[model samples]
Target: MEIIVVIGGPLEEGAIRRWLHQKLQQKDNQKFQFIGVDGGCLKLMSEELPIDLAIGDFDSISSGDKEILKNYAAKMIEFPSEKDFTDFEEALMWVAKSYPQQKIHVLGAFGGRVDHAISCLWTMFRPELQALIPYLSLEDEWNHISFLTPGEYVIHKLEHTKYLSFISTGSVKQLTLKQVKYPLNHQDYDFPIALISNEFIDEQMEISFESGGIIVGQTRDSWR
Candidate 1:
């Protein structure tokens, strides 16, 4: 299944507009199922997009908007404002159980409180979610974040994603980056490093790891 999870966490001071623009980028899009958490429901609605499922405490939405969502959403999963897991986590867990092989595109998850963004980043590290990494991509206006298991992978150039970063979640052995600005030849990383930024020199990039795994962040050239 191709799924898109929209989380309504707080965004950074200047990011909300760009984030909204990113959502607007998808017009007449009919390829994926949308899952809105909290205020995210309104986001999808504003875009004139159909919502497949809406899940959240929904304290952020007005009663009238909630009624519209209930009528428009194909399925509703409501929970109390006070819960053990975050609304996004709850939605993710449900997705994991219902569609284990899903390729998830997450938006409206970053540009928030630092900790909140970290929580979204760590979702890929979860035991239940790790297996879904290769199929998962956390996206925003400036980044395409993904987690990958040990294997050879080829990544193609995407319009907005130019800079690349590979971080070791655990201990990655013999990790290699091919045909990039800074190519790595069988490098080993026991502890995680910033690996902050690199660029693509060609249309395609080749990444591989002999053991362990990596969390890859493909970002835009926002500095330009």
Candidate 2:
């Protein structure tokens, strides 16, 4: 099964509509199950989408909206307003437990507050969800980002997205980049600004690292 978790980020209504439509067009949509986190519930409801479960503290959503969610959602899991886990984290935990083998596509996770965006990206490090790396993606209007472990991997360049950036999550050693406009070999990249912007020239690109983790951001156009 494919799980699509829509988190409640401060996204524009138009973007939300477009994203939901694009999601419905995916080949996996037939197998896609929707889970809403906080304001995400409202977005799904606005699109008349079927929500399998609603997981959040509901602090961002109004009481009326919560009532509507309780009516339409197959299952509802509510947490205290002052909880340790963010709504997105809670939703991910549920997915990790219920659908370990499923691919999770996270939307409305970016383009909000910067802190939220960073938090959403770091969700991949949750102990329970760490084993499911490469299965979770955080997508926004301009880019798609995913984490990679220490191994060689092939990433196909998305149409119209010419630039790809790799940011080391930890100290990376012996990192190699191939089939790109700017290639690197056996280099060490520190946390930030080391591998900021790199362009992909071909249809496919490959990257490998001997040790440590990295976040690969495939972006369209330019980073503003």
Candidate 3:
């Protein structure tokens, strides 16, 4: 199963638009679902994509658009604007609960206010969703990000760029990187390290760590 969830964030690239359209059209052979959170519903409607479910307080959408959503969406769930979680957080929690075994692709999760972008990335660390980290990613036009647990992962390089960044909000123990331009072995870091401009020497790169987790961003500079 593939679940694509669109959040209310900036999505400006024309390529991203085309890619999403292609994805929306390829649901013929699998269990696919499209969910729009808050203004994401408006964006999907504007882009002429089918939205299976809409979730959020919806304060960001106009009443007219909300009416249209009510008619077009298979389900529309509204929460109070004063809730503890943000719209995307609520939507992600729902995904974590409902589709624990499904692969989740998140779009429109970045390119917004700096804090919002941070929130989008940090949401992957939520306790309930932490176990599903390997099956989720926050994607945009040029970036594919996934949170990694304490294990050895053979990650394939993205053709978009030779850049791969490893970010740890907390400490990482005995982190090792192989088959990359700059390799690290048994390293300890207390802060986030971008490990920027690192090229993959082989088709596959192996990353491992003893403790803690990190978010790996496979991205390109040209897209920003």
Candidate 4:
């Protein structure tokens, strides 16, 4: 099963359809568990998308909207508005605990406030979410994000993505980039750095690192 988590970020009906279509193409005959976070449930309903589970504090939306969610959502989990973790983090924790074997694809998490975006990115590094690193991804029309541990990986370029970047959240050692426009040779970085704007020379590219976590992003300049 694939869990689709939608949050409160900029989203378009056409873009959401296009993205979901791509996901269907990749995995044929798979079931989807739609999760709506707070105000994001409003967008999902407006788009006529399914909401298997609704999660959040319900503080961002009006009572009418919450009533709509209560009627349509198969299940709902509510949290306190004054909490330590963000709604996104709470949703992730719930998903990780409940559906550990399922792949999680998050939407509407990009193009928001800089701090919110960063918080969502770092959620993967949480100790409880460590096991989900390989299975979790954040994507939108313009960008696709994934996490990588210490291992060699051959990742293919996503459709409409022109640039590939690898960013380190902590110490990254012996990192190498292969079959890319600007290749790296086992370079080491003690601090976080972004190897940005690198293009793919072919359909796929190779990357490997010995230590630390790397956030891989494939992005385009705009929605074409």
- What is the TM-score of each predicted model, taking all chains together? 0.83, 0.89, 0.91, 0.94
Per-residue lDDT of 35-134 in model 2, one digit per residue for the tens? 9888898888887888899998999988887887899999999999888887787788888889887887788877679898888777787677787787
Q: Give candidate 4's whole-model lDDT.
A: 0.90
- Over 4 Å off in model 1, which ranges? 10-30, 62-64
lDDT of 4 by residue, 115-135 (tens): 888988998898878888988
Alpha-carbon RMSD to native, per candidate: 3.5, 2.4, 2.4, 1.5
Deviation in angstroms for 137 in model 3?
0.6
lDDT of 3 by residue, 47-156 (tens): 77788999999999889889989999998889999988888888888888888878988888777888988988887788856767878888865788988988899999
Worst 10 residues of 3 by lDDT: 13-22
- lDDT on C-alpha atoms for all candidate structures: 0.80, 0.80, 0.82, 0.90
Best by lDDT: 4
Q: Clashing residue pairs in candidate 4, if any?
A: none
Residue ranges of candidate 2 with Cα displaced over 4 Å: 14-17, 20-30, 222-224
**Candidate 1, clashing residue pairs?**
12-111
Candidate 4 similarity to native, TM-score: 0.94
